[model samples]
Target: MADVETLHAIADAAASLQVLIQDAIEWKRQHLTDDLLSALIAAEDEGDALTADEMGEQVALLYLAGHETTVNLVGNAVLALLRHPDQLELLRRDPGLDAVAMEEFLRFDSPVQMSRRITLDELTLGDKTIEPGAFVVLGLASSNRDPRHFGPSADRLDLGRVDAGDHLSFGGGHHYCLGAALAKLEGQTAVGRLARRFERIELAGEPVYNGRINLRGLASLPLAVG
Candidate 1:
């Protein structure tokens, strides 16, 4: 069937990424000294119970998580600035607000849209009961924009918000995203670079969105810079 073929294609891409991670790890072990690979190897040597396959899985996870999320965060932040001229001007005037600008940008259009978890037991949420084994998709984007939590114009992108740190874009609780700090740093760096370079930037065309509903981000965004 066509659906089966499409799934196979996706799986193949994922497998290829895994292979790339393995190759990168080998390269690091040969070329560089201290890095994520080195840290993982050290942990393995220190009586860590992970098998070879498990170690591969760990590296694969890091590669996928770190690569895709950081890329999306930067891309999404650029897209946001392109859409909002006023916000861009604000950043242009006050360069020191890069950190706050990045946070506000992320909150406005998070690279990661949603994540999943299963109900451990029957838990009531509003009128519905999340039965055990029920797959619950947490909408991080929606939660970030909740009017009750973020005040009146929850959807508005305001860089001046002092408590911008409360956004659920990085998730919450147990799985609060390991690469949160790294993603923020990348966003800050990329946005600062772009702000310094272009006086005005606008979207040239409609952005290409990933078909995946879970891993939401722009696949491509053509921008008109001036």
Candidate 2:
């Protein structure tokens, strides 16, 4: 159950995003090119696949899924490395470790924590039996930290962990995130350059979270850099 304040916060945030989505669509209309927005626009103009209203809907989902979520991915990566200096130093010492470290960061604290799924058929797993049409909330973070696949040190951050890249952060199967590769590459570049560029990056104050339910991320990450 959500309190009035929480409901209001969500409503406010959604409204702001809708404004941004409209702005993006308008911008893309003025400057059509061979890009994502143009591609979506073509779907409506050429193929007649998406209605004008649904064009807005698809833009909202893509922007939220692609751009908004990546913000958290980088933020989460930096925070994780800060909490584990040894891990941060590993990247600082070896730029090659950036890619590997990003994987561990995703596993350590997945940017998006939960995914919603409807059971297609009856299924039994462990001790619980879920009936068909059951709505299940998959915990990406929980599965990433499972000891069964990640070993006893699953709870700890290990940049060199053999299976660290095999996380559920981008989901799996046909529903797998199309932007997973780009997201990982961006995370590697951002966190890597940040560590190498700064002589010192230390926490200046407590971090504040954005309070989004599905896309877990920091609203502000205070730091002192030299």
Best of the candidates, lDDT = 2
Off by over 4 Å in 1: 30-32
Task: Give candidate 2's total backbone clashes.
Answer: 0
Candidate 2 per-residue lDDT over residues 81-104, each given as its tens digit: 899999888889999888888889
Q: Model 1: per-residue lDDT, tens digit, 1-226?
A: 3598899999998788778777876776667566768888777768898766777898888778888888888887887777777878888888899998888877888778888898889999899878899989999888888989889988887888876778888888898888888888888988888887887677889999876676677789888888
Clashing pairs in 2: none
| Candidate 2 off by > 4 Å | 1-23
Query: What is the model-wide C-alpha lDDT for candidate 2?
Result: 0.89
Report lDDT (CA) for all predictions. Answer: 0.82, 0.89
Cα lDDT for residue 145, model 2?
94
TM-score of candidate 2 versus the correct structure, residues matched by position = 0.88
